[model samples]
Target: MEISGIGSFLRNRRFGNYLEASFGVNFASPSKVAVKEEVEKKIQSVAFVEDDGIGAVLISWVRIVVCFVTMMFTTFIWALIMLVLFPWPYQRIRQGNIYGHLTGRLLMWILGNPIKIEGSECADEKVIYICNHASPIDIFLIMWLTPTGTVGVAKKEIIWYPLFGQLYFLANHLRIDRSNPSAAIQSMKEAAHTILKNNLSLIIFPEGTRSKSGRLLPFKKGFVHVALQTRRPIVPVVFTGTHRAWRKGSLHVRPAPLNVKYLPPIRTDDWTADKIEDYVKMVHDVYVKNLPESQRPMH
Candidate 1:
């Protein structure tokens, strides 16, 4: 699409209203009432539950054991394959993405959560993806929805996570040290370069960390710089219900509806370093306004 078209679309309030209506939320615009009602009926058909009990606790532990075993077995097998293909880094990384994707899907299936993905048609374009962080499963959710060449930008600490860390490294996902300003800057540069060099879409949680309150957190500015530096359009993705499925600091996984929406990409051709805050706020508002009120950040 032309840059002008993108600009016009982004500025179009009606489209934003339409998105809100699609999520079963009331929009200030009167024209969206019909759409809003339709979405509400659909949403009502799918039950949303929040349970914490003895059975829930037992189920959660079983899921953890099963998922852990599955991950370890799969990661070890992938590790062996990686060793054999170590001489061919590109092929190794490709295999790692495939392995990660398959393993993630398996885990989701085992968890028995019904996933409803929207705007998957946006996957055709390669762009920088900025998503809300709410659970550890956010990475897997994105991997399952996006194309094969997508990589994630994670914190440096994730490199020490057991089997998952090894797989993350083998997948060639970029990791940065949040504590070291200089290192973090370098990682951002590397992320931009990696996207251009590998022709892969990069996923970054601008929030920097998961939300403990299930509300959107203030975004970090590093991703803004990454988008401007790479000159790639920014695709705002929202993963609702993941926190309900697996809340932060919880070991149990609930069988909840998982929603993934890929919103339109905003062109970054005219973006500059000086407008970083404005850019961040624009995207942040898109998430805050679109999400259900219960999922939005508390004022």
Candidate 2:
């Protein structure tokens, strides 16, 4: 599980503090769940399925091309499937899980990086999965790892992203209007209701945006409120290597080992109004402790 020379390299650029503070949990080396499946010869779809990129430049561009084209095709198919599954809300979301998993799995395979997931994936639990937001790939990777159907709380602007946005809406994820304080609050309540009624795990990135510096950003209180209101356990999912793999402000999807570890679930039964801030820092610390040494939160 050790990555050679990455520590010193990050320190040289002063990004060392970021890795350690990112995840506060100590997850033992759990069984490695390899994301790469057996590569089969498929001549039918060579245009989008080729994995023959050699140099990093070629490899990265290949990923970008394939990702764009494959997403278009898959999203269209998913939209159609979702339309048919519309009568059963839960069934539609469950199918969205499989569709997203397949898309993410394809991206992982094409990126040609090994992914290691630690801890158990929760299924059939109405819990909330909170994690640090580092890169765009983080969300897609989360979709690949989480055990059950997960509804996310994202910014309302995401609804404008063409076909993918339609797919997102069809999946039953909640959206918050970040600019409107009251609307955002109402969105949180709606999210809680969705969790309870649908019996699905919720995924939220409390930082509100991607970390441009790969450091842990200060969390907003919205997700904390949702977890408290819903009385759902909060599972902190920590990720390493994604910020470097694709990084912020970068377009290339370079090959790098992506690691995901789910920390112990925090019980909200004891997290009353008076202790909300304390629990926030506690959960944040668990994420920081589990993060790599260099990425730890600055003192």
- Candidate 2 per-residue C-alpha lDDT over 95-164 given as tens digits, one digit per residue, 9 for 90 to 100: 6666666676555555655455556543336688888878878867766555546777789898898876
Indicate the worst ten consecutive residues by lDDT in candidate 2. Answer: 35-44
Each candidate: what lDDT?
0.75, 0.68
For TM-score, the strongest prediction is 1
Model 1 regions more than 4 Å off: 1-44
Model 1, span 166-232: residue lDDT tens: 7788767788877877878888988888778878778888998889877899998888878887888
Q: Which pairs of residues collide in model 1?
A: none
Let me know the TM-score candidate 2 reaches against the reference structure. Answer: 0.78
**How well does model 1 score by local distance difference test?**
0.75
Total backbone clashes of model 1? 0
